[model samples]
Target: MLRTNIFTAWIYRLQHTDLSSKHTAVIAELRILLIDENRQRAESLTSALNNSRYKISHLASPNISLLKQVDEIQPDIIVIDIESPSRDILESVSTLSNYNPKPVVMFSADQNTDTINQYIESGVSAYVVGDIQSERVKPILDAAVARFKAFQKLKVELSDTKQQLVSRNLIDQAKRLLMKKKNLSEDNAFKAMRKTAMDTGQKLEDVAKTLISLLNTI
Candidate 1:
């Protein structure tokens, strides 16, 4: 009886763990902004995308107000159903692209080659034309999100590399000063610098900078 009870408890725990893992694997709810002059079309598009993983909000207004709505909603994706590529629409999206975490997709019913080229050049992540379908929307959204995340990671790495280079340069300069002032070898100077850093609870780079500043003043 004791063995049976232990097995049952283990099985229950295993099932619960599996369920939690599955839930976590599902992407977080995405916020979508639908901009279209045709109220009916916007409503239909919103309904189509209302799945478990997406929380869509929509706006059916003139092009001028659409920009304001986008600022307020701060959507993960913006699906613009353009019948014609109006100058105002293009300008608004162009301005919005300057923002961090820009919108993912822009769609239109009219598929003019020149317009498509312009949209791509303007930093729009993905473009689609004609009646949008579920099959088309999902893949584009996935790619856009992936691309934005990659850009963010690259930016962070670049910033970190720059800081490290600056720190190394400062340390090198400090070591040279110590060798000149104390007649110590490079390794010994570094050791003394490290000891100073440990004693003062200051970073090695900071200590190096301070040493350089003092040397400069003299």
Candidate 2:
């Protein structure tokens, strides 16, 4: 009995250690899509992030086919080095955010509040306004990844909440239609819908949507 207990304790400790290790793992060796028009700045950034942990892919500027490149390369993160992030660039980044979201670290010379806000609203994760050193690159990237994770979590929660609200509205509308058309009480209306859903082996939302569509057609 004592040996079994010790073995159980050892297993628990191993699991606890593994959880800690996973937390530290955070982001893996990321495939970075580095965008910089200036050749000199690009070279400097390449040298700075020349570590085994990062596989850097370089792009000169935001082109018409930047989205195509993103689809193909599918980099974990995007690092942009530019004098001032243009409206065109910000729009392209926003497009990327909509389709395939990823952490974006933008280093720009312009310190204008409007530009900074635009970058953030457009989904740029880390916006460094001024010249940043090579030594600061890794830390900045790590921070961006962390922020992106938090933002993504918030987005998921918001989307779920919105979906729930829409589903509730749909069910309520369907119930109202049934009550008026069938001359049934509220509880009876609900039971009727539930029975239909169960009989058809369909989701409540799907059943509600179908009822609504039929009612609308009439």
Best by lDDT: 2
| Model 1 C-alpha lDDT per residue in residues 1-218, reported as the tens digit of each score | 11223223324434554454465565787787766677776766666666746667776654556667667777776666655344356455656577545555666565452234434323445555556566545545555555455566877899999999999999999999989987889999999999999999999999999999987787
- Candidate 2 per-residue lDDT over residues 1-218, each given as its tens digit: 11223223324434554454466845478888877787777787788888646778887865665777777888888877644354356456567466667787776766552244434433346566565578766655655665576688888999999999999999999999999998999999999999999999998999999999998899
State in Å the error of residue 161, model 2. Answer: 1.7
After TM-score superposition, what is the CA distance of residue 46 in candidate 1 from its true location, in Å?
1.6
Q: What is the TM-score of each candidate against the true structure?
A: 0.66, 0.69
What are the lDDT scores of the predictions, listed in order?
A: 0.65, 0.71
State which candidate has the highest TM-score: 2
Candidate 2: segments with Cα more than 4 A from true spot:
1-22, 61-68, 83-90, 93-98, 110-123, 183-185, 213-218
Predicted candidate 2, C-alpha RMSD: 11.9
Give the range of the ten consecutive residues with the poorest summed lDDT in model 2.
1-10
Off by over 4 Å in 1: 1-24, 38-41, 62-74, 79-100, 114-124
